[model samples]
Target: MANKNAPFHPIIYVRGYAMTPGEIDETTADPFCGFNLGSTVYRAVPEKERQPRKFIFESPVIRLASDFGYQDVYEEGYDILDPEWEADPDNKVPSRAIIIFRYYDEASRLLGIGQTPNISQFADKLRLLILRVRELVCKNPANGIGEDDFRCHLVAHSMGGLVCRALLQNPAAEFRAAVKHVDKLFTYATPHNGIEMVGVNIPKWLDMNDMKNFNRDYMAEYLNIKDAFKATGRVDWLPEDSFPSERVFCMVGSNRMDYEAALGMSRTFAGHGSDGLVRIENAALHGWRRSGKNKGSAGDSCAKAFAYRAHSGFLGIVNSEEAFQNLTRFLFGDIRVDLWVDVEQIRLPKPVQDEVLAGRKVSALYQFEILASPRGKLWYLTRRTAEEDSVACLSHEEWMQAPAQRQALYLSSVFLANRARVNPRRRSLAYSMTLGVRVPDYEVDRRLWVNEHYEGGYLFRDSIILEMVPPKAEGDAWQVKYAWQGSGVSKADTAIDAKLLGDSRMEVCVPFGSSGSPGMQGQLRFIVSLWNKEAAGN
Candidate 1:
């Protein structure tokens, strides 16, 4: 029975790392202790500093897309409640997480019992926290909450992201099934890769239970490490397949703070490009290699924000507006963005040449090697099947490695520098020179070419192996021969001559021009044709 009247589920935001008692305390702090500890905490902060409290655009449509409101209890001190919670009194937004604690003593007594530490232990507690939120929604009744109609989105910061990853990637099928209802997940500086800060010389007595040690060396493959740490229980470091990549999205920060010693000189430090504690790399999904200003050409790429923020301080990552906006976008809107372009319609800059042309120029001619493969043979066969009968003869070894199509042709671009020009008109100019390209069989039309130029001539032998010959020798020469074209005079190679401008460089009026043919004009593409030919003796 589908509940057509069921409203959208509320967003459940999760915060990370409240390992300290003073940090998690929302009550009055010691006034005469010299410093206000509450003012310095990272996780517990104001509204504007937490989520995107302000928007660039003011219109309703734009506001909905970019709307970010601060919604945490301990972090905000109950001053500003969620607008969704107040407006309808129906749709409620809650923040929660499972608090897994490490057992330190023989009785495995819970640390900070009744305190924040005790409350935060057990990942199951985080689940319960979320469930408690759902119960609140159900109590309102006006929120359209039903037993089977509740769903929620998760937005976590730092260690909160790690807990989310563990829940989603946990290998236990039962655990996954419990929260399989979760829809969207957004993390900021979660350190999905691994946390390196634990190695810092923090007081051992501070966390005698030592959960940091477990995270440093064995978060990815946690099962083995956990088993070793325990005497006989089900020792698994990361829950079996706990946090699968697809279940979550992340926004990582990179803080640009000075190298200061406020936290202690010996504290294990994070990367220079970190949001104070979580390195940008670790904060994101591992193996999302694409970074920097450029985005991917496809729709379904990863979300990464490398911003500047301190590790763990008052004005750190949690206090940044940019981090909040990116997080909101990834969670509420479609994560995937698309980009389209026609590769064949793109053009390259013209090749650069500086030296004045002479009837003869000094240059060297050289040859190159060809690598054949089984896949290569298939490439040749598919493209040139009509001419297969004529060029079909190849050795078993060559056939094994040759491309199926005759497109394994190799090509090279020639760049010249400092060529002295001797003009009968006046003294030679000291201008730098960048000249032409030399290819095998100026009349040939193929994608891949092995440089095989003999004495600056345009001729190819019957051998399947074609090698490129160099244009110049070791020593510099005065005379130069710049006239050379790709392809032959046969009907099969007519387009080759029309496109060849003698000098491949001269073919480009623009920069980086290859061949000037209409086929190679917009799309500077070349297919390498491969043939498996028997060796002379074989």
Candidate 2:
């Protein structure tokens, strides 16, 4: 039986964009099921080993758009392919992609199918499809019915991620709400940012043709292309504006095999740091912020919930274990938080220390969010298995103990070494460093929950306190004090004097070792103030 206070919930896995026949095949192709659903690669083998396999080919239900008919070289000059140019050589070639959904039973067996054409019409058709799926599942009797009726998980690949993102961010409140009913989303090789399809510059004449035929005003009526284009912005996979990252789990491939292809492109749009097509930065919610530190709001609470993983290639990303782990974890974790910590101290380059005299001031602390249960038990979520009673608790020291973990800790450093290497201000010696926020809790919370309420309310009323020990120089001791200025304040600050951190870290707590409350509702402020041994100013 689940603990009375546990809050465990079932998970729904949502996968991302899968290119349709139009998007991938020069001619019309079938909706290609990603490697996770099992590849359609017809493996040659011995005649004795031959056996029947589940095949998903083109669905007769959907028709190909005439404009999408195949052609040789693209005529469009615009960086992005516009649908109107598919027919004319003078026009830019359209990016052919597909949309298909396959429902699965609880046992993970394919149940039914739904397919749609890659129309220029914004998500208008996709919105209707979401509603139709809801209605169909609820009404049909042969469709294995259950109390958890809304069991569909949207699995998209490539451009399909963009389609799903549009669905999730639909202005139509009904459509947005309907899509929320879907359990989860899984995406593979989705260029959340615009994909670089062999970067073709259209002739100046094609630009004029777009103004005449595929003009924003003209396509706005039936296709809503203007808004869709606006939402996708430079990034075709995600909307131009921010999205709720929490609900979605993005899988990004970091392989940069097409380095030569991406060399001529602008730094911002270059896919050299991406999976042959989409950049890793774009695969995540664009306006991602650290959970606790206020960086202004992206306006969508649900959107804040998402997890991302890095793998090698476009096709390999979907078929790899990393993708599967990220997908399943996002659908199942119990504690979710977007955490980011800045290492201002690391900015010191050794020689410059005497110039400033005192150690560099920490403009921002190494911050990470804590998504433990109401009962202050992080162990509930971290435990390895059901039979295990304890889970490994990670402090800043343990977290960055390994090289891989340390590298992850210094994200800003990582980005700087890669595509973000250009120095903006050489004359000015000072440099600004920022690290990408890690939805650290998302992997642990959504994926590791024993039930909906992490460990099924095992902790009851206790609140968690998270502390990190930094790697500081020996004998250069410092004291750490914590304070919170939220709706409720603790009676006294918790002070740690010991060398809790081997280097330069101090212990910090959430809810700050305070007494339990009737229920977990109010937000508590947590501050870790550092003081010198001489009791000088912090």
Candidate 3:
């Protein structure tokens, strides 16, 4: 029997888009669609000359079953849709099961009359499917699961994420009560703001063959969101009141070159700052604000992470370890921390300051690199860099704004498993994070500019070490230790200071400098707090 207090729940996997008829036919032919697809290779660095390393992942479907005791509901090559299958007299379904929302089956020639429905239709079907799953799991007494305790997590990839959103957001859709059954939603490379091709939003006028499903205007209508056509404005794709944004996780893909689709034309048209298809800016659901006037609004911020994987294929975000770790941790992990960097001051070089003092039009672009690794692990839990992955870009003007009101750069949402700690008996968690500030190039007057001597394109960087120990009993304060790398021969060689600020909240200032040199004077304000797990609905 499963642990009564355990957070383990059923997971519903939704696959992505199938562009062509052949692709749809091939997808329908598969038993698990793309959820069963696994990869044996990965590239540590996004370089053409570097060969990918051999890392075997037994797919999400197999991993969930092998690692967590989750099972598929099929029996002897028979699916729930099979006519011969009937409900057991006990009215029980497995506590942990995976249900693939085969929304594209009817579009395939082998299944139906090759007629595809719009996203709204798919969402309507999703509502019914949730009801079906609830009946199979909650209503069954033999499962020993209560109706109030029955909930499932939705894991979707690409356009399938939009389908999940529509089911939860669209008011016109039937089966409204089914939305309550969804506990959490995780999306991989979803275009929440709609896809753009060659710097153009796929025109809404092109409705032939359901091409308009990707149009922002058309999506707004079906997803029931307001202000979808705002080109340079913010749009909230997920409804605010329907579900808490904290329970939603968006896994963004940054490596565009590895997505070998459409004879390499897909990457060409999608351009840079994307996962070869969805733009990095558009990949996440909206309403997440770190600062400014909208800081404390309900459903304002959702958890998100950036990976170097592409949208799909061998290097796809869904098939990578980065995505898998994030998925499993978000669903099962107990501890959470939301990190942000507030720029207190940005000191420029003497020459650059002189140019600005002389009324010369000068602007510098800075990219923020972040990497997090747990103790006793060589691989990073999350990585965002300038060269190979998602980099937060800001201009000099943006940095000089008021520090309090200025928007804070979101670092990463770190989730640590209580049982997976280095020393489980100690009830302590240890992790190190490195933040690199890079000024790759600057613009004097919106022109191509290059620095004469650039060392690895980094202007400043720092690494932080954090150790956390939550209180075992209520009313007791939590304990945390934080230390940063100081200038020395090595991190261990330096006399570091580990400070404890109260219990739940702490503030620290990390000075940034170049590699092996300490002169580029700038400091980043870090505000670390223990995320409210109860309020987050975890």
Candidate 4:
């Protein structure tokens, strides 16, 4: 009776941190916290420059209900988990639903005593909640769901992510069954490594209001990773064996200027390269790859994206179109594509070339900017730019001295669901990528080269657009087409086939600029394949 093939399991939303008793009561005041809150955003189209378009994004709750037919478990002013809760005997709640993990209720003045629990205790209660949800969905004769058929996904924001991580990575025997029932995890702007203030990690001794939950040493104890303060001295990773890293997704926020807490004191101390509170570098896990042997490698790399939204506010990451679109696709997507850059060589600038020819020691720094968007959509899937301090950096010496092989960088991953596309009639899946390699800042003999310096200049830049139609069935070839924004090629030109890797995988290589010259040059390799093909065969 399981609907595993449908891939629409229950989504448990765990909200982010609330620092005070007042904030605790605020979360308790609302039935679904802020999950039910909708946001209205304005868009200015380039074609109609002056006319701003109003895009009303109904909250995730509303969209899920209207688009996916998911219903909540609340009835007659009481949740299914409430002590006095009662509902129609034959009308059971559907398997597709959203459950709010009210971990803060026990600490709320209106709901319970005003004392917050530690992260471990919160995770423990989550285990119990998962069990209770199964009882509600599986025992009912109306839905035909069995105990074996029930599975749930965890969706958390900020510190809430840490609470879930504590459960998933918990090594204790008691939590194993609950961990098994959780199929996937998605987090938004979570400080996975622990929060840093004034360029230092938050001390465990700062134990006010259980703020020590954000401390790295304390987090290591709960996450059950020993010596997590690795050579990098950061615990921004989970043990590979704890959870299937591929099932996890992280959404990193880059805009800190919009956070207005404490009259902007939060953003000031949290500083740049942060989402007003959690730094971008600490937002994602170390090991989060969907495929490959990560047994002894550095932590796995989860599928993640970057957004310009701040930590929490009207412009926060949780309630935005970009976040929602990503959430829907990842939860029920058909195809998965990962983009990586293999730098064959980086040609130096005219001036830098002259210095290198003179056999002088020249040093430089290269930064890469990546932004991706789905076709016919105003919002992007991921955003990383120098302006947001979220771009990738490479040292000239490392690329030169390191192995000549081309496995240097990864941009991001984007998923596609024909079911979630703009036009149902159109069969092609398309997205555009804006990738740029900045001009290196030359340091001749470790000294700054200010003479020929210009700000915001790039050695190479282009928008790569890809349009593809999935294989009609398994073992069939894929029809892929691509065009470059500045290359004078159009989508109407022709379609290129992806290079088929054995086992139903495909790859498309898009090369840019000239190689081994006095300009930047490299290849963007796209690995494409069926995602959860068992669930959605299309």
Candidate 5:
């Protein structure tokens, strides 16, 4: 039933919170529990009033079915979760299936129990679901699935991500081995650090539908991060001994205005830099790797991406093309590229330069933005800007400090070579990244200077598109081509290649500077490496 071994593991979808009874019922009523719901709109698409809409990406469930031939366990009007549902001898469940972790079913009156279960119980159900899926996949003898080789990928949104985390990080005595069955995790707009509103954490007293489960203190208890939380004041972390955070991909949402929950009041409470319900800063977890500066400190953060999508809606992060693309690639991609920015120098404007040259102190803040996307797509995989309140900002003093003193600037990582390329004839994997630095607000002599300032001005902006052709045979030379957008120049025009660092690694040096004026000068360094190639193909 399966040709591939690593990447095609069965995917189990864990849905988000059902804050109220009606929402719980609505989720319970659905067969796939909203995992089957599709979206017709994306962040770049205009409002519904705009016509000639040509883009309509189906739900993740349908996409998996159509693209990868994954099927559900529903048969005879019964799901695998149903006790009465028995395996059909004539038809065996496909090894590659999209199983929904319907943790909320027990909470609906139409289903089992009428009361909603807390997050702990939800984790319990998740463990059982994995084991249950294992039993089903192993049922068919021809499938050749065994307990030692069977694994599942967990795709979750919001609180559902926490459920899986609960299982992985800490499970009940009965389900302590649940972590062994999970290979990778992908979270959509999950408040890994715990959800906050109005600048305060969700209170423990507010127990509506167990909303208090989001309280940081409470989460630390169930997730078994109490000591970590006390030491770091955060519950967003996965113990390396249990599961490395690098295996978790977090899709963080940036648009709060489109959440529309509570008639847009939720956005107001979440304020800016949020997805209405979850703040952007709280949407991802910290990794386990420690940095060189100190041992036993958090370093090499968990993989995460930012999009303009909201928490959950037509514009939600879950149902959007951006999220779907990320989810699939992280699960099955063969190439992983991590981007880093090294500022060689930050030149000032003519006037600002003159002030600095005269020995007068000048203070300024620089906002850096990066937009990354794959080939043949209009949407971005990871986007960060000042407007999104997620951009990397550096003060002039910070820039003056040595790179060693300052924390390394990590833009985002992109996974590729999973979804079959559009042009099978072309054997190269390609993508583009746009890096821009906004003109800063200069303060000479500690006083704000606005005389020559113009709003919405950039110090430098350009797109670096890369085309990587894999080695035809082992030890053969791998070819790489690159160019800056709108420069009237490409590798096709002038044959060029990236500087090869070593085996399985390539570095593309893209230098940027303002024309005819004193401005920023730096080169973006991209390190592309082979992630998991066993499943890579056209």
Candidate 6:
């Protein structure tokens, strides 16, 4: 019988890039190649007076084994790969096996001739690996799985993600059947659009040591998506026809300071708007032009989450609780909530409001910071800060225009109902979302301008807790309870009569206000939709 609590397929881990010879040697020496790396960290208390408490994360590999009864597909210190092993019908691999792609071993001096092949070759090897996995796991009648029922999840980090995409999008015609065996793709800090060093994309001419693999031009040629690139930006590597985008998830890192790679030189060159190495803009698979025109087709944007993590090292994105939670939930969770914000109106300070109304050429820039956390968790599932990560920036002129121009800004996707954490008594999923509205600075007539002093660098900041209970009856809709922070002790504690727009869509208007600060008011209309899991192409 299949384990209903665990993921229904095997997991293949593809590690990220190894830039230097030493890095390559280190990766080849490790059996798991950093996939089993663990860390001990601390969380900063909101109050400065309190000391941060320690937290231990026993790695994703350990968690999978301990929490879901998954086992590593290894025997006698070797991974099981040969088809001959199937001769012993009793020697069958389980469905919940973790397999590591040791692609770098062939390039390491310790293992091979130290001649690294190009990514395309690695992709071809991936195709063969999937076929090998299917043969070992599916052909065994003892496993109680049919050949067509066999599938695998590809979880890759950095360049490994590109490798997975290369297999899915640009595979040889003869190896096309390999793509069908991939159930889903999850990437951690992969440069889906190719990495940028400084302000320029890695130059195609800098092919030394195969660094050109990250060049956009080279990527366009190899990934076979030349038409997706415009003069300014490029579309995602995975095309909709090859693999449904919703089945892919991109976990983006935003913290650049903590990455200690190259003695901190990597962060210096990668610069701002990056996770030490990969820029936030290149971390996601969604396509966009310089003019902000989304070239990706409807429903082609993959699910993504942003965390305050570096590209690699001690504070790596893959080694974070935020990333781990997102990974497991996306793979096994039953409920998925895609959250977006709709600004009905943005009110400026009285003085600035008057100046703008008088047509005094007043210009303002606003930054929106968003963070989400599960009900009992102190840390956030996703975090986007104004100073560190990419934030929604709007100008005064843009704010005054119709809401249609602003449209809706997608924040993040949160998955709930993981079998490991489901509470039968609660029968609901609860989360808290924090939004901060900040005006860093303004300009008047192309000159420097200042605004009224505000605490926390934000004009408005509030946290809203939402509880969603699944409907009990067939026609009954989901029950939603929402209340802003501080509403618990005030009269604002009231359940909203949220209309179920569809089977998976709901809208709620959250009141925004600044306590003790008059003339500041607005409402954030949140459009929440549950993703169609079946159609998600997993």
Best by TM-score: 4
**Positional deviation of 29 in candidate 6, in angstroms?**
1.5
For candidate 4, write residues 1-538 as lDDT tens digits: 5454357888899998998889999999888888787667532221223543467888889998999888887777778776667445544557788899999999999989888888999999999989888888777665576777678889999999999999998877778878888888999999998998877888999988788888888887887764556444667776666788778889998888777888999889999999899999999987632235643347547888988877887767887888888888888888888888878777776777788889888887778899899877888888888878888877788788863666468778898888867889988888889898885468887888877577887777888889888878777788888888887865624577589987668998877775444466678899897877656641
> Where does model 6 exceed 4 Å of error?
1-7, 43-53, 82-90, 235-237, 287-300, 357-360, 400-406, 418-422, 451-456, 489-493, 498-538
lDDT of the structure predicted as candidate 4: 0.81
Write candidate 5's Cα lDDT for 1-538 as tens digits.
3334567888999999988788888998998877777788665532334443446878888998898878887878888866657645665666788888888888987786888878878888888889888887778775677776677899999999999888887735566566787888999999898888889999988887798888999998988877677878988877776687778899999888778999998999899889889998899888642324453457557788889878988778888888888888888887777787767766677887888889999888788899998888888989998877777677787776673442347788888873557797888788888888885588899998887788888888888887777777766666777788769665422335566678667776666667656476676777777765544541
In angstroms, the error of model 1 at 94 is 9.0
Clashes (candidate 3): 2
- TM-score, per-candidate, Cα-based: 0.42, 0.40, 0.88, 0.93, 0.90, 0.88
For candidate 4, the TM-score is: 0.93
N/CA/C clash count, model 5: 0
Candidate 2's C-alpha runs over 4 A off are 1-32, 36-99, 102-122, 140-151, 196-244, 258-271, 287-315, 335-339, 342-344, 355-538
Number of clashing residue pairs in every model?
A: 104, 72, 2, 7, 0, 0
Q: Candidate 6 residues 1-538, lDDT tens each? A: 3322235578999999988788899999998999898767633422324553567778889988987778887765557764455445556678888989999988999987898889989999899888888878775555666666677899999999989988988646756788887888999999988887777888889967788888888888777677666443563556666677778899998878778888988888899889899989888885322223454433446888888778986667887788998998888776777776655556666676577788878677767788888866867788888767567666677756674453456777888763534466777777788888787766778876666655457777778887777666557777777777755532124577666677666776666766543223556665555543443343
RMSD in angstroms between candidate 4 and the native structure over all alpha carbons: 3.2
Query: Order the candidates by TM-score, highest first — what do you get?
Result: 4, 5, 6, 3, 1, 2
The 10 consecutive residues of candidate 3 with the worst lDDT sum are 489-498
Cα lDDT of model 2 by residue, 365-395, tens digit:
1232222211211111110111111111223
TM-score of candidate 6 versus the correct structure, residues matched by position = 0.88
Candidate 1 per-residue lDDT, tens place, 299-322, comes to 122334333344444444544433
Better of 1 and 2 by lDDT: 1
Sorted on lDDT, best first, the list reads: 4, 5, 6, 3, 1, 2
Taking the tens digit of each residue's C-alpha lDDT, what string does model 3 give over 58-163? Answer: 7999989888889887765666665544544432467688888999999999987798998989988888888788777865555676666667899999999989
Model 6 scores a C-alpha lDDT of 0.75
